[model samples]
Target chain A: MFLSFCDGNGSALGWAVLITVVLGVAGCAKNYVVLLPNDDGTTGKVAVAGREGVTLLEKGREGAAIGGPAGKTFMVSDEQIAEDFGAALAASPQKPVSYLLYFKAGTDVLTPESQADLPEILAEIQRRPAPDISVIGHTDTMGDAAENARLGLVRARSTAETISQLGGSIISPDRISIESHGEKNLRVSTPDNTDEPRNRRVEVTVR
Target chain B: MLAMRLLVLAGAFSLVVNVSSAEDAVIGYVKTVDGDAVVLVAGKATQAEPGTPLQRGNVLKTGKPGSMGVTLKDNTVMSLGPDTELVVDEYLYSPSDGDLKLGASMRRGSLNYISGVIAKLKPEGVSLKTPAGNIGIRGTHFLVTVEAKD
Candidate 1:
């Protein structure tokens, strides 16, 4: 009887531990759904949220700073799951990087140096895992804001066209927004000397 | 007695005005596509169940799946893609009364939009929200797709 009692207790303890180990293995190996309280993309693994899946973005509006959604994760519902996935997949928000390239004078064409730098901008775009880009043009205190915006747009478009035709990697024109600040963001803010050569170039940024 | 009569008159007038001012609902789903103006809420077949009341669209389906060729009352065209979900959260018409507003949220997939009157009211009036961020628009046409970010 004494031996039997001891054996029974040992068996019970071993079974409990064995069950725990099995569960641990399953939890660690398989991606499963663990219901979360919030709507953010916490819908567990393989579960898709339907209702709260979409996120809206307006012009000048920044969305949630979502890092890459790698590894197993969870979401609350199908909708939230979708939204989180969309965000995870969306391109990084790139703040336009402005560079003032000074031309010799009032010329629509880009000089050799400026042309060379174009490759650098294209290279930057290629660097990101998936980079978003935009180009805003600027001019010296030489033309009207409306005309400058138009000219700047044209310049930006021409440069973008060249990049597209490079045939290395195709960048969609729609993805690139080209506009002119019309010297609003000047490279140099000399009170008397508003017109600077540095202000006549294009700015490129990748996110 | 005279004062009570005047109060009742004012109350009646207020009630009548309130009844007149209730806003109506205008909502629809993509019915079919016909080039520019996509159909919304298929009037298909012999259902003859009238149709979904039209509302000032915050988002419309056009030349896209789910809601292929849906048009808004404002004449704005929304082109949506397969497996994509869009919601017109809030929309208002009549600028003088108040600015006509349009708001949309995308759950998945891709979409394209062409603005009409509401956008005309405010140049930067349209807003598209994705998980990554919000897209602010002012007087231009654009398209967007949802993809995994690295």
Candidate 2:
């Protein structure tokens, strides 16, 4: 039985033993990573930087890299983005601030007509440093009822989104909540068929 | 009968129709409405003076970085967002295609576009130029602001 074990060519057997021992020593026992060499003459796994295993979490275009060989994780979150999205929804509800501001029929464009009083609106929003600005848009009985309602909401949200883009840090978009009245909630009611421009508007309520 | 016919023409609300729909140019949606304008108090209008009548086809035309604005004929105004550029290819007062066209580009800065009758049309007629490309209008409007890249 012992001769059978040594029956192989002595030189070949020696080399095999050496290779087996080297492989056993090189490979990790468990829960560990080992570097291996590559063929093309360039060191591959030996010089390669890699994670044995990892997991990643992504939000929007952002991602959080974690659960790898290293305990530290890579994460990216912009305070500006957080604040922008948190704009007004985070606040307690309230009434309209003023009437100087107006909303376009289907868009969030700030009209030049309000240029006379925009400074006040800016000032008001500026004062609420951390205040969440909720811009709610509404439409009267002018256009299609369903379309108007949807426009009300879209206008509100667009306004908030615009504010976030034009931010002087007045209000973050994340902290903002854009809402729509859609003729449902009216500051001035025009029950049956009244096409009053005053009924279609956008309001920036501070929290 | 002739006098009444003239009066009817004067009081008639003309329907708006799409013009040059095939043109590469497209208008953008109104982002906000101040009094009647979209964007306000940007670099471009500052040059036009405080009370300058901002017209629809008038280009903001700023040599400096982040400067642009537009005033619709209806008195609606809009400021350009950063890094954006557009041109008023065509516009129509009667809702007919090709009546009037306004286009501008925001090379860099935030843009504030306001709605007039144009946005009400809701179509490819209004397109917001963006860094990634153009944003088609679906009636919903907004002020687009982009960062100026060196």
Candidate 3:
């Protein structure tokens, strides 16, 4: 009877230890929810109290800071999670890069250095899948606004033609668009009729 | 009875874990794509195109020569320049209820942002995160750029 009692006590102790471990794990892992708490608080700041730390949040604003352990579990508010926060966690689109190919004075011809950069730009466009191209022309303030506009378009058209010839594999005619900003949008701002080499260029946006 | 209680506790714990990691929700759609842009969500890359519904937690990445324009539900127009990485992070907007929150993070590249209803209603509610520091939106139109880290 004594041996049986000892065996029974040992089993009970083992069960208690298992239960404690499970309970402890749950306590440590309880996830906390973020509370916006105030709707009229757009001008007002809301405090997000989390295990990581407290973050003071304002309206029309977003951040990628840690609200919790993984820095991901931010919005679990009173059984109504802020789904928009999840979208914030998701990847947005990448930014587009542009290359400016300078042109010769009063002509649509590309400068030697700018011509050299054409292959590099083409390679950049070819690296992507079905890229879109925007060819915008600009000129120095040396000419009249109306004439500069026409010249810009001519420059853009010439660049487009070159891109078409060189970009056989990737450049579909429909994917390319040409525009002339002319002297209206100056790369280097100067007085009217001022000639600037930097401003006489074609800006190509390859995305 | 003890066994039943233990089982209940374990079940409850599992449920909490599942709820905390719920799937991301869609917030807006891609209005335009100039080149090669993609939205990275759940480890999968989705080509960004017109009418591509954007979700919270989506990471936007552009290729070497890519650009993307996005319109949010509240009419917030954002144009992203190439080689950019942006995350929506969090956005909560309900005008009638007066619950407005917008948050985003730009890891690299340039973003041209025009204020939407959220910013108009409460300018202080909008915040943008960058490598330099946090940007609090007071004006309606602005541009932000985060260059690539060496």
| Candidate whose lDDT is highest | 3
Tens-digit lDDT string for candidate 2 (B1-150) = 999998777656232122223332212222212222222323243342322333334444333333334334322345542233344534544332334333444444444343444554534455545342343333322333333445
Supply DockQ values for each candidate: 0.04, 0.03, 0.03
Q: What stretches of model 2 exceed 4 Å from their correct place? A: A1-100, A104-109, B1-150
lDDT of each: 0.46, 0.42, 0.65
Stretches of model 1 off by over 4 angstroms after superposition: A1-102, A111-113, A126-133, A143-147, A167-169, A172-176, A190-193, B1-150
Candidate 3 TM-score versus the reference: 0.42
Q: For candidate 3, lDDT tens digit of each residue in B1-150? A: 999999999999999886554434445667567677999987699898865767778898888678787766555667776778899888886653577878998887666665566887877788877664565654344344454555
Give Cα distance to truth, residue A51, candidate 2, Å.
Answer: 71
Off by over 4 Å in 3: A1-92, B1-150
Q: What shift in Å separates residue A105 of candidate 3 from its native position after superposition?
A: 0.5
DockQ-based ranking, best first? 1, 3, 2
Docking level of model 1: incorrect
TM-score of each: 0.34, 0.30, 0.42
